[model samples]
Target: MANTWNTDNAGVSALASGDFDGDGHDDLALGECREIADENIDDPCGPEEFAKGGGIHVHYGNATPGSFGYRQQTLNQDTVGVAGVAETGDRFGAALAVADIDNDGRDDLIAGAPGEAIGTRAGAGAATLLFGGPTGLVDAWGEGHSVGYQQDTPRVPGVAEAADAFGAAVATGDYNHDGKADVAIGSPGENAGSGGVWLLPRASVNGSSAFTPAKLGLPSPSSALAYGRYLSSQ
Candidate 1:
């Protein structure tokens, strides 16, 4: 028999409802991903950034107030588009998180991706960042590709790829004072292309729900991706 039971968010996706706004009524803090991409692999590029990897359709779900994965939808134009990060070019978008890392009283999200990467698309490729706006979650930042220092360095959202990516993230704290939450991305490897993580502090960020796609300027090896969970649990 196949094992199928997970109490924690690890190894599985979930959602719930609560007062993320700290308001009397409940709010929405959800995790969305391309659990299933409804469209065909148009193959934006000949070789394609996802050329070698298996194509993964986009899958996304929404939360009910404080509930994570409370409500999900798998339809084109239903929600945000590809994070645009090169790493995630090949049908990526599965990892996701929703927590109040910034402590803005309202809940926020942190996306994770291991396979998300861009091919040699140059300017045509960029990174991806979708922020929550007056409407809902929307593709709000970065293009969809990593270049120069950003490449080999998955830590930063700039020039990084949220595509075909995988890994994990944990809430640290609101390093900034933007009434939002903060999070850190991981790239379990070593220095010099070994991979790294990105630190996203909350900002007064508002508008089309776009993020600048930044990298945490931590010391070299900001901290390996494998042992990143220590901060999330503690």
Candidate 2:
């Protein structure tokens, strides 16, 4: 019988793919950004009390060719090794990007939780970086193997403000011609509707530092442009 999973209003909100296991066949990552859940482990997917409490499902590819029918895993803030806590409106998997940030031959996953609160700033938005390894996605790093990015993070531009939506969209590339990958994050709801994009270097992905797009000489957009409503990179 074919494997099946179900949830109401927990539709696939985002997607990305990579050979997470280095098995040559590409794997799949699906985001159910509208998923609802609570702290009740007894009834993990219930009550609808935590709307927009998103999650992701990963399916490693099989040898069948052109299929991703291998083992499956579900992840969310509440997952034992994942970072953060599941809260109403956090929308953890609303956006996703894939890249070999560390150039370790394994592609990493970048997730956006546009409704996350930064400190006391509700809806300030945030991004989570999950690394991949020979054994598939692994959280071997001390900080749950997951690193978070937000407006208020040290060296990251801007302050954490309500509705900033920093993780509303995401994309990745080697912007500086560096062998490692860089990331671009969108805050379409920033600056009272004047959206902005932030570019984080590969070093940042490895727990080093951050850099805004402007520092790379990208011109800023006009007021209210909502520049990062959608973003892309090679």
Candidate 3:
């Protein structure tokens, strides 16, 4: 299959990237969904919906051609024959973050899947974590691999407490500096109308041939914090 260089799909909304494998390779992350640009296409993204619903997908690579492969890793509402999953719809990975939590030398992903929104077709979203391994991605559904996610209502009190809506996410550095990585999200347009932020700190990554993904939110201080408050770069 031909590899896609620039990840700009009409079927894909937002695109995010980072070294998800800790292999020193920055992987291309995409959030699939439809757009609701008022009165049309060719509109400028002055911070508005661009695309709309599929799911989230990631491709590893560099800027030059052939730096990446056709292979990919993905997560959706559909269960891979697993149980205890409440099944979701039209939900897609609105944002993505990747890091090497636990410093096990492997990378992992954190995705934001917002649900449907009012006054628009956009989703409100949730979060996801996918672990990496030697062969590639150690996804939850596949064989010889294991996966987990943040418990519902994980908690980000001050971030978007009054918002009731979780938006895009961006992963930062290993907060505790344990040599691992972490996750962060931004919730713009809250109830009070300003905006908020949320973060997820990855704890134990790999153990016993399994990949466990944990999530923690940033402590939302009552006063205003920095935008991208908990976000960091390589």
Q: Which candidate's lDDT is highest?
A: 2
Predicted candidate 2 versus true structure: per-residue lDDT over 71-148, tens digit per residue:
655667876566778877888878888887777777778888888987788889988888777767744331235678
Q: lDDT per residue, candidate 3, 1-234, as tens digits?
A: 011122355556556665555566666666644433555664222223223334555676755655654456554444352111323443445555556554567665555554533223334444556556654453444522324332233343432232333544445555555554555555443333234455455533222111111122335442333233223334
lDDT of 1 by residue, 114-232 (tens): 44444552212111233333223422241111112223344444343333122333333444545445544444432323344445554222221212112444444443333332224
TM-score of each: 0.42, 0.78, 0.55
Q: Between the candidate structures 1 and 3, which one is better when assessed by TM-score?
A: 3
**Ten contiguous residues minimizing lDDT sum, candidate 3:** 206-215
> In model 1, which regions exceed 4 Å deviation?
1-82, 85-94, 99-106, 120-129, 138-167, 170-172, 175-180, 190-195, 203-225, 229-234
Best by TM-score: 2
How many clashes show up in model 3?
A: 15
Better by lDDT, candidate 3 or 1 = 3
Worst 10 residues of 2 by lDDT: 1-10
